[model samples]
Target: MSAPKPIRSIVIVGGGTAGWMAAAALSRLVRTGVSVTLVESDAIATIGVGEATIPPIRNFNGLLGIDENDFLSKTQGTIKLGIDFIDWTREGHRYTHPFGEFGFDIEGVKFHHYWRKLYAEGKASWIEDYNLCATAQKLGRYTTPVADPASVLSRLTYAYQFDASLYAAYLRAYAEARGVVRTEGKVVDVLLRSEDGHVDAIALEGDRRITGELFIDCTGFRGLLIKGALKTGFESWKHWLQCDRAWAVPSANPGREITPYTRSTARRAGWQWRIPLQHRVGNGYVYCSDDISDDEAAATLMANLDGEPLRDPMLIRFEAGRRKLAWNRNVVALGLASGFVEPLESTSIHMIQTGVSKLMALLPDRDFSPVERDEYNRQTQIQMEQVRDFVILHYHANERTDGDLWRRVREMDIPETLQRKIDLFRNRGRFFRYDDELFADSSWIAVLLGQNVMPAGWDSLADAVDPALVRQRLDRIREVFRRAAEAMPRHEDWLARNCPAPTASVTRKTA
Candidate 1:
């Protein structure tokens, strides 16, 4: 006769970006008469390596009622217009995978259709010319989008490059201010209910047993709660992902105009990531363990840095996989505890946000309904698998013959979903987004074309359009993007004037 009451006590095990993000989002929705406590240890170290993010992160921040400028300043963040992929297509080729739409659709047909017609007639320009973010990134320019539909600024989307540890600290203050409790100690044991085998509470090092109606595991690759307690299985994707070990380090900024994008350069055995923050640059070499030794990987990472290393390159070992079930019994796993896909596409933080969001949508009661867990796991499976395929496309679809790593990846068998997408595009540059997945059409186009996967034929409808008119329209689109990008302020100059990070007493200075 009455609506079901939500769970009252929520316990978050572990802390870092994942733990605090769950706390912050929950604090907003479950403010009154609900207890949310987080348990973390000073001795346990956080990976703190996911510095770059994709565009969806902005939406998560907006939903949390966070100001972009404040968040940027606190995290010492920099704008990320897109990612610059170097040597991906071949030994000497490069490409830009920008954030927004390529151009406007005309007469109920995609804009790329018309451009394809012009290409066939030998009159069209490069695809990058029509992309605002690519042009702006090339010139180190950045500007916020406007609400006006008629302007090219309307579609400009961007993300951020920040220090992951600082972001966790910032969110900690926010969550604590909103009444989320913080417990400092290591978890010694997990207690499960005898009746349903659900986790009831965790025992801390001080012999303190804290009980809760629900639990969230943010324990990085260890999977203490999801795997250790509930025994969720893992599905490895190493064959497609290839790279499993990474050596990360921070270096002095090269001071080369501070471009508004992340750069991923293909290497002899793996790839190097260059993420430019406001004060310094974050660099890492991710390589396959079988192809190269840890010593070789570390040296390769250190030798390629643009500036002197701030510290020794930290070694991180990971398996490219996903938890078979993200939610089991009364415990839900967030962040690395759930699973990992390498940081190639910057999907780490985004995955954590999505997990918390989906939990809130299907927020359960003390009764622990199996139906909700089933649906949550189903959705999570779809999201992760889709992302996995996208990441694999970058490695398996390459034209590089550089070394064993590249050669093996190029010849590896790919998932059917990605293979179908590649085949469709290769036959004709046609890509369709399914069920509003994470990456959109423009993302696929960028990587496909960037890796030299050209369409063998154009759409038949594209041929119906007049060639002269197509060329004229295509030229206009490129010019509009060029003019819009030129009007923007330089990325470094804009940050200094609008959202500069504060200088800290410890760690590093905010440039």
Candidate 2:
């Protein structure tokens, strides 16, 4: 019946996007007499290929009070309207999963429902036509969205393509400036308490002992604290997500106009990602090792570069899964330390951001109640599963005949949750969002339709609207999006005029 004591000292192990982000976000606690210390070794390198992101990142930046323009300039950032998936459904086919919503809803019926009816009647264009982000991406345009509800430009949403290392450095400076202590050393050992089996302190290589009330693990895939010390178990999803290896390399810019989107081109054995930053382009080939050799994967990546290779390809090995308990005992895991779904959708950093957000929301006291721990675990598992299913959809719904990888994934048994969504959409375009999943209805609609998964019938409610009126409205919306995109500045021009990196040279090219 005693009052719970508040946590005082907080220690973050490892430093990269995850550790620095946790430090920066928790820096506010310094004013409340809670010490935040981050320990990292300068010798360790991070997997910095997480250059693309979704729109929620803007909210994360806003939470940190980061100036958009300044952050872009410092991080060599470029706008990412969404991902352009090439040859995913089938060879020679393409589609975009844009960040913003599709056409406006009509009379309480979803816009896609009306579009489906119109499409079936040969009166509608591609779903991307009604999306301002997709239109702007196609036109190579860039601009911040407006607040006007009536304007087509107001519907635009975007994320960033930037150097992950530069972003971590930027956040490190921010955290350090806000009084978060940074210790330079590698952790040699983790000491645990006797009675409760909780992490008591970390022993550094140089005979340093750092003690804290709460510990955060950001040690990449090593899971140094959460799994290494606490013995937390991992639940692997490798069978469902089989691409466990990647060959990453950077390439020189081709001097063409920078695009406002990320490009994911499906390969014979896997897929390749192209993320353009202001200074250079980030490229990677993620594939299953069983289907392709490391050398072959690297060769494929090098052969497809738009420009000269900047460095030798780096091979990365990983499994697609999450720790069974993200919050085990008093230790919380973030980023790769917690789990890793492939960066196909660029959810790595977003996962770290959400972990930090959830930690803040359910911050615990010295008692470390199981109630709080259980809730955090539940939320984390659900969110990870949702993302896993979304990523799986891209592979499962493919129509490619290039390699066994595609065929196997397509024929594989996906999670029942994903199956339910696909089944519902296939029936009558009846898709539903569960547990407030990360990808919204618009996202699902885009991938479902883009990959040629047509619904058998339109929503019953869509039948109430007049077909002619729906077609007219759809035509008007498409034209408005096109004209609005045309009015925006070129992506390169916008970067030059607003937040170009010091080393970036702007080049104008006809779209």
Candidate 3:
């Protein structure tokens, strides 16, 4: 006996980054004879605010056979080495959470342990000063990692800041060129089968009924297919993650030294993000609407801009949570429809990419197995929860005393998993990654120490290495990072020379 083949007709609703990403990846990876159609309305606009990204985006681009320079040029992209958090810990404090490791560990013990011992004795400096990525980012430098494993530059990792609409448009063309059929219309109706209550097809405004064996819901926050039709429950994380609204707007670049890092500056009520792109800078404030009015939040954002405002900031409301099941019956939700965890770390696009990749991994058959669906939902839950905990750490672990928002966040109870990690780090300066979590050990250590969460004791292994040798190793690493950063080119110069956005003559119009 052989397993039954999955359905051939796949329909994706909506055409932003999520929809086009799903269509493009499916068209490129799925077997031949399978039809992929995406329907989106011209009147429907996407939230184009998520411009900054982490390093995993490179893997997603690589999966689609995308040329790095071509994609960067098409999207008016610029390099982002990591994020610089200002005023999060306390007033007059700043820190850089770089992408790569800070320093090398010896005998399998983390390097933070040795650094803790030095700091306790008042002999060491900031941990981030030893990170190549952090140093390069702070200096407005950009360069791909060197090939030599022995070089400190080899450990540097980076992502990008680009126009989200342009990225979607880029992927749209890529998918269309690869045989994806795109339908233009608003999804007015979703038809479900009576026998199993699974989504069977969707009807457009003109009564044009399109049928498909499997449906992908990329309908933004509406969740038209997954929650609207299938009634998948949502797990509200408001208690843990409380910022429920955001205001985004673009501004003219300040023409200041353009560093290769995103800036997240803490405000009285929320945090304001400054993301530098080649064309313009992206800025926004994420705050709990209850603590601050929309007008107040907008004003706070406008008042904090590095440059003059280019447009009236747009407000986006959201819930902090995830769908109980990302994949339900014959429908799988992607992007905002699936759930939102806020863009604190710019994980919105990455989450969409991960959702699509998971669907592809569990590519189902016509007879959707409970086994496969359960596994997909289970994994999705774990990943989202892990990310949720990480995001919560920024808020809960803070030492800010600015206002009600900061006081509340600082006192709120956090998830046990995050608490455990914090306790472990504070106790022994030790950190461990479980189940291949997204944020690595270096990230945890950077954020933790940056916020003044110092460990009480050093790792036992640090005792084995001579204290003088540890100091020498630390000094050597810092010098290597400084030299490497000095050798890199300016971020703006690199983008302009390597990947310039397409002109009107060569650009594709969004149909």
Candidate 4:
């Protein structure tokens, strides 16, 4: 056997949030001598669908050395404390899935269990009151968490809602400033190596051919390099997630206070997202095509906008699944090329960030060892399935009988993993995190309770605490959180003072 060859050239196909994210990560993380090249054409458009993100995004940006304030200003970003799920359990029903932990653990017991005891007696305040992020978000407040362990502000975790397109531009500039090379062209054909059946080079429209030791496909749902060229297969998860298409549009803010959280309102056949940014609101209706027509979906989105429409609704087609092998041979797929779990929890960009981080962790030589690829695929599969389950929980645990779409999801069988989770939660509110899955126990509890999936029994250990003490602590905690939120600066006021974007560069468009 010959000696292993180190990867010298890295080629990334497509350019968008995913492509640029990979570029930025590789350019910064990859050591010297390994060149990173991104090939894309100006004619291609990315889905740019996910505007809101989860809390983990802070780590991703921190890795990129991005200043939070600058990123917010440049990307027209606003704080996202959590997601307000409206009409999901039923019409007019609402709940907030926040980023931070709930009431602090008292004497080594979960707070929710004690709350459950009170909740059953109709004495506990809404579960949202125990969470700093949710409480503050409800009060239109915004503040970054502090490092001090004693301060309530320490628990105020959050994410961001930003312009996806602008984020890509910002990352492009960052990646270029590093060492990633940007190639402007469209891939017309692919050349393969005979021995290994790996992509050898890609022919551009203008007779330019670029070759590399490895390829990263960020070609969105088309999977231009992974599936189109390498013939990698895909796994459809439509049965679990029926929302295969989305219609997106931006709207003016209409002079209302910018809320520091995303709102997902359940529509007749699907759900619509309202994400507030510094300049405009990003709204999208993600519906199952089989249940709703494109025209009706578009109309529903238009009629529900909080402000005047700024652009024609852009339709995006997708399948809720992933590639059978994210790293097939020498090709690795990212973004929609890998798979989509929708934006219900604002995970689109976070998935991309994770993909990049995993790839870097398993960086391989030119030989592209199967061990590395297999590990990458295994990790990716686990993370995707975990996220899929979380998103599925939102759809599968619905109480709404008003729509066929909800009925189908409600009655349909889910993965055994998710089933077991629901069962455990239903038993005594016991839910465990496996392999460091992205969603925490608090998140599960939030959704479970929000959708009215109550526990038949609270943890018996919760009974150890004196009933009077539990009540006293719960009331004190709730009141403290409420008063703290009431005192913080408003979301809009916070942005104006710190990270406000330059006055809308383009005139606000109206329908």
Strongest candidate by lDDT? 2
Residue-pair clashes per prediction, in order, are 0, 0, 1, 0
| Residue-wise C-alpha lDDT for candidate 4, range 351-452, written one tens digit per residue | 899999999999899878899999999999999999999999999888886878999999999999999999998999987888889988889989999988
Top TM-score model: 2
Residue 233, model 3, lDDT? 98
Q: Could you give candidate 2's per-residue lDDT for residues 108-221 as a string of tens digits?
A: 888988988888888998899999999999999988788998777789999999999999999999999999999999899999999999999999997999999999999999
Candidate 3 worst ten-residue window by lDDT: 502-511
List TM-score per model, in order.
0.97, 0.99, 0.97, 0.97
Descending-TM-score candidate ranking: 2, 4, 1, 3
| Candidate 1 ranges beyond 4 A from true positions | 1-3, 504-511
The global Cα lDDT (0 to 1) of model 1 is 0.88
- Whole-model Cα lDDT of every candidate shown, in order: 0.88, 0.93, 0.86, 0.90
- Per-residue alpha-carbon lDDT of candidate 3 for residues 14-74, written as tens digits (9 for 90 to 100): 9898999899899964457889999999999899898989999999999888999999887
